[model samples]
Target chain A: MSIAFFAAFFLAWQYSIVWFDIPRYILTPPSVIVTKGWADIDRLLYYTWITGVEVVLGYAVAVILALPLGLAIAFSSILRRTIYPFVVCVEMVPKIAFAPLFISWLGFGLLPKVIIVFLVCFFPIVLNAILAFSSLSEELSRFSVSTGASVWRTFVKVRLPAALPQCFVGFKYAAINATVGAAIAEFIGSDQGLGFYIQIVTGNMRPDLAFAGIFFLTILGLALFGLVTLAERLLIPWHISVRHQSR
Target chain B: MNPLIELTGVQKVFGAGPGALHAFGPVDMKIEKGEFVSLLGPSGCGKSTLMLMIAGLLDATGGRIAIDGRTVVGPQTDIGIMFQDNTLVPWRTVRGNIELQLELRGLSTAAHRASVDELLASVHLEDFQRRYPHELSGGMQQRAAFCQALVHQPATMLLDEPLGKLDAMTREAIRTDLQALWIQRHPTVVFVTHSIEEAIQLSTHVAIITPRPGRVERIISVDLPYPRDFEVKSSPQFIGYVRQAQEIFRGYGVL
Candidate 1:
């Protein structure tokens, strides 16, 4: 169903561009984008790999840092009261405002792009992790204690697994934000990556190549999202949301 | 021998000062070892509050609750609890949930495998042991919960409406299973329920309680034989006991 819709939309796009006599430099047709993509497959793949690496690495770093920080905050009222407001304050600032600062400190290389991605993706992971841990059912906690489970046992056996489904919600959001962060960082200043490639091609009046880079970015975002979903299925098959989905 | 569970002047108040709400009790009760006692009351009667105190999940504003001669300062290893909700961890299989008791007690998987299997067999859920809680029917989930409570072999079980959420047929089936299980294990059980019939059907004694600022209105001995089956529900003696309980509730303005 979705495939047919996209196919028809592409045909309309192709015909409308020709019928309106739109200049190729402004809005390239689907055929032109595809031809450009095919002709520059090697270059596209190379730059796509760079952006993909930045996104995955930044997302991985964000999850690693956010989970423990979230747990610490959730477990302790002192930390939650002190750190949570500061986190919200920092999150409220426009993340793009940090791009120039990051580039200046880390230079116009992959480091700045990855850091920007990490900054963009960090808040959701932390917030979701905190919410997941804190929102565990009181009944489960009571049952755990009544069964004589130690604090550590309750955390590992009950709390951690219970938090997984909500944590995956953050992961999905972070996956998409990861690509956008990488792209925004590259747009500001970078030497290599899909975003850099698009900037170069568009400046040189090659919308076809620019559109090709965009197509690859969309695929990258989707693939990363798919990976997060796959991990969720593997880790929490017993979750109500996931269980019903299978049926 | 001392009573398995003893409560003297137990009470709970939700807050302090002028706004304080007296939730339940200035009540005393006792159950001998291996007895089935039902706490019968109306909605909002604080029956569950009393159970929580006995399980050491909540503190009484005043008075004492002791199990096996030890005061319940906090949740103890020797007591098992099941609430109205199944409380099954969603990410675990039926077998996995049952094994949680053993795991929490520091028993390794290899050591507890046989016991877990036996628990599943007893509940007739051996075939569905690998299924997750959401995949099972309500009765099955309750059965799995019962196994989770029993697997650790606690000497006393505190159940707060454990089977209250099931359909009538499912409830009857699980009640039968519970009776059979109880006969075999003989754990001292304090079951909280609003159903007078349920209280009489299972318990050796029924502790009838009044609403908010709940007190033990009366205690009635069931005097029914063990291994009770569905036929007991239709028996004239059972009807007499139900009538006696209803009259008490009527006097208390609860019926």
Candidate 2:
């Protein structure tokens, strides 16, 4: 159904082009996008890999740092109360504005892009981890304790497992945000990557090439989203999200 | 045996100041090995709280609670607990959830294999061992939870309304299974429930509790024979017992 809808829309859009000359770059036809994409395939792949690496590395770091930090915040009331408000404050501020600052600090290397991705991705992972941990049933907590489970045992065995579904939820959003943050950082400061390609092409008024760059970026985002969804299905098959996906 | 479990002048107070309250009795109780006792009370009577205290999940504000002569400074390894709600981790399969205790103990699979298989067979969950919690019905999940509670073979079983969430027909089915399982293991069971019929049907002795500061109102012995069926509910003795429990509740002005 979705494919059919898109096919019909493309046909209509192509037909309208004969009657009105849409700008060559901004609204490049599907045919031009395909041709340009194939022509620049090698360059596109190279830049895509670079951006993809930054996004993945940043996301991996965020998960590693956030899981333990979030667990600590969730486990200790004192830490949560003292630190969570600061986290919320940082989360509310627009992270895009910090792109230039990161560029200046880290220079034109991959460091700025990776840091930006981490900044954008960490909040959801941390917040969801805290929420999931906080929402664990007290009755179950007591049951674990009475079963002779030590504090550490109770956490890994009971509390952590219980929080997993929620953690995946945050992870899904974080993965997507990580890709976008990386692309934006590339746009702000970089001689390479898909984001820089699009910025330079659009500046040169070659919308078709710019649209092709965007097409790759969209594919990257979709691929990242697909990867997260696939992991969620494999790891948390019992979660309602997976059940809903099967439906 | 000198009481395997003892609670001396145990008091549990909740909150502080004007909102502060006492949930259960300054309980003084003793249970010998292998006794099946029920803590019966109306809703809000704190029967659940008492069970939790005995399970070492909660502390006694007033006096000492000891299990097998050891002070319960914290949660003990020799106790197993089942709550009214199915607390199984939904993401884990039945076998995974059942093996949780053994895993926490860091027991090797080779060592605990026979015990795991026995528990699965005893609970009739061998076929469904790989199934997730959501895949099972309400009754089935509760049965799985029961098996998980007993997988470690603790000396005492503290059940807080384990069957309270099931429908009538499912409740009846599980109650029968529970009785058979109880007879086989014979762990010193302390069950808390608000239902008079359920208490009479399962317990060897019923400890009726008062409303707030839930002290024991009475302890009625159920000397009925074993292998009793659901048909026994229609008997004159069963009716008389139920009525007596109701009267005990009324005497406390609870009903």
Candidate 3:
């Protein structure tokens, strides 16, 4: 049903542009974009690969740092007061504004793009982790105490599993932002990647190719978001959100 | 023989400075071995607070609690505590959740395999062992939690209104399930509940507590026969005990 709806919608979009006598630069139809994308499929896939690497590497770094830091903030008041405010201040700064600084410092290689992605994804994952780790049930906490569970055992068995669903909320958000972050970083300064490709084509009056750039970027974003959703279903099958969706 | 549990002038004050709330206590009581003692009180009367103190999960502001002659300064190891919410780990199946009890205590789940199965069977959850808590109904989830608490065969069970959220039918079934389990294994149980009749049904001794800064209002010796089913609830003697408790509540202007 969803596939058919999209197909019909695209057909209408294709004919409507022609009926309105829209020029190719002003409004390239989906068919033109697809044909142009197919003609440059090799370059498009190559750039997608580059942006994909940036998104994945940056997201991985963010998760590795943010999750534990968030847990620390939740576990100790001292860390929460001392470190969290600084993290919030960093997050408060417009991340795009840091793109030039990153490019200047690290150069326009993969590093800058990856750093931008990390900056974009880090806060959400950590904030959710903080919320997830601390929101334990009172009875469950008492249960841990009564059972003589060591701190490590309780964390592994109870705390980690309970936090997964909420943590995934952050993960999903980070995955989506990762693509946008990479794109924006590339836009500020880069010779490679889909963002640079789209910008160059748009400047050269090839709206069709720009649309093709957008097409691949959207695919990368969807792929990451969909992967996270799938993992969430697999990991926390008993979660209310997951169970409700399956029904 | 020394009592299995003893409390001496136990008090729990919420805060140190002025405007402190005295949640419960200055309570003193002794529970004999293998006795089912219910702490009965109205809602917000601190029955659950008092239970936490005995479990050694919450420290008393004043007084001492000893279990088997050992002072309870930290969390007691030989007890299974259940709360109103089932608290079954949502990530685990019913069987896995039950096994967590033994795993937490650093005991081998393989060694206690027989008892774990027996506990599951007693609760009629043998078939649903593979299912998660979310898939189970309210009664079934509570039953799974009950099994989880008992899998280790703890010497004491601290139950804080474990059936408060269930429907009337579900509550009755679980109450019976609890009675059967207690009869089979005689663990020293400290059950906290707000219902007068429920206390009478399960407890050997009903420790009625007054509201706010709850003190022991009266200790009613039920002396009721075991397998205290619905028939017992309607029995003349059972009716008399309920009336006696109601009359006492009247004295406190609570009824």
Candidate 4:
């Protein structure tokens, strides 16, 4: 049903562009964009793969770094107090402002793009991790303690599992932000990636090609988001959110 | 023999200085071995707090608690607790939840498989052993929690209204199940509940507590026989005990 609605909407969009006599440079019809996308399929796929790698790698790195950082902050009030303000300070600065600095530091290569993605994806993972760990029910904690579970055992068996549903929430947000970060980095400085392709096509007054690049980028973002959702379902099948989703 | 559990001058204060709220206090009690004692009181009467202290999950601001002649400096392995919420780890199946108790005691699954099976059978949850907590109803989850709490056969059990969330019918059924289990195992139990009939039905002695800064207002002894069923609740003897407990609660303006 949803697919049918989307198809009808796209057909209407195509007809509306022609009916309104809009120029291709300003607004490309869906049919024209599809044809242009087919013509540039090789280059588009290549760039899409590059962007995909950067987004996935950056997201993986962010998950690795943010989970433990969040756990550390959640476990200790002193550490939370000491480090939270610094995190907020860094997050307060628009991450895009760091694009030139990253390009300068790492040279306009994959490293800079990856770092941009990492920076964009980091905050949500950490915030959600902190929220998940800290917000654990007191009853659960008490039950764990009553079981005479060691601090380490309690963390591994109870705390970690309890925090997982919320952490997946962070993972979903980070996955989407990762794509944005990669695109933004490519926008500022990159020779490859869909973002650079979009820049080239638009500069050459080919809105159809630019829109094709955008179409692939949207697909990439959705694919990444879908993968995270799948992983969440696989890993935490017992979570209430996941169970409800099945229904 | 010494009391299985003892609390002397035990008190809990939430904060310090003038703004401090005295939650429960100066409460003294001795629970004998193989006894089912219910701490009954109104909500916010610190019944849960008192249970926490006994379970060694919370420290009393003043006084001390000892179990089996040992001062409770920390959580002891011999004590088991079931909270108001079932607290079943969402990720674990019913069998997995029951096995957690054995695991914590360093017992291998192979060694305790029979016990786990028996517990599930006793609760009539053998069919649902592979189901996760989310798949179970509230009563089933509570039963799984009860199995988890007792799987290792801890010497003492601290239950904080473990069936408070169940519907009336389910509550009564589980109450009977719990009584049968207690009869079989005879562990020293400190059951906290707000329901007067629940306390009377399960406990050998009902320790009626006052409101906040809770103290044992009185201890009402129920001389009912063991292996009690639902029929016992309708008996004249049961009515007499319930009326006596109600009268005491009314006297303290807690009813």
Better of 2 and 3 by lDDT: 3
In Å, residue A166's CA in model 3 sits off its true spot by: 1.0
* Residue B65, model 2: Cα distance from true site in angstroms: 2.3
Q: All candidates: CA RMSD in angstroms?
A: 1.6, 2.3, 1.4, 1.5
Model-by-model DockQ, in order: 0.73, 0.63, 0.82, 0.70
Lowest summed lDDT window (length 10), candidate 3 chain B: B83-92
Q: Give the Cα lDDT of each candidate.
A: 0.90, 0.85, 0.91, 0.89
> How do all the candidates rank in terms of DockQ, highest first?
3, 1, 4, 2
In model 1, residue pairs whose N, Cα or C atoms come closer than 3 Å (at least 3 residues apart or on different chains), thus clashing, are: none
Estimated TM-score for each candidate: 0.96, 0.92, 0.97, 0.97
Candidate 4 lDDT over residue span B200-245, tens digit each: 9999999999988799988888999876776788899999989988
Choose 1 or 4, whichever is better by lDDT: 1
Q: Write the per-residue lDDT of candidate 2 for residues B81-119, one digit (tens) a residue.
A: 888786788878998888876776665656777888888
Regions of model 4 farther than 4 Å from truth = none
As a whole number from 0 to 100, the lDDT of residue A218 in candidate 3 is 95
**Alpha-carbon error at B112 in model 1, in Å?**
3.8
Candidate 2 displacement at residue A158 in angstroms = 3.2
What lDDT score goes with residue B118 in model 1?
Answer: 86
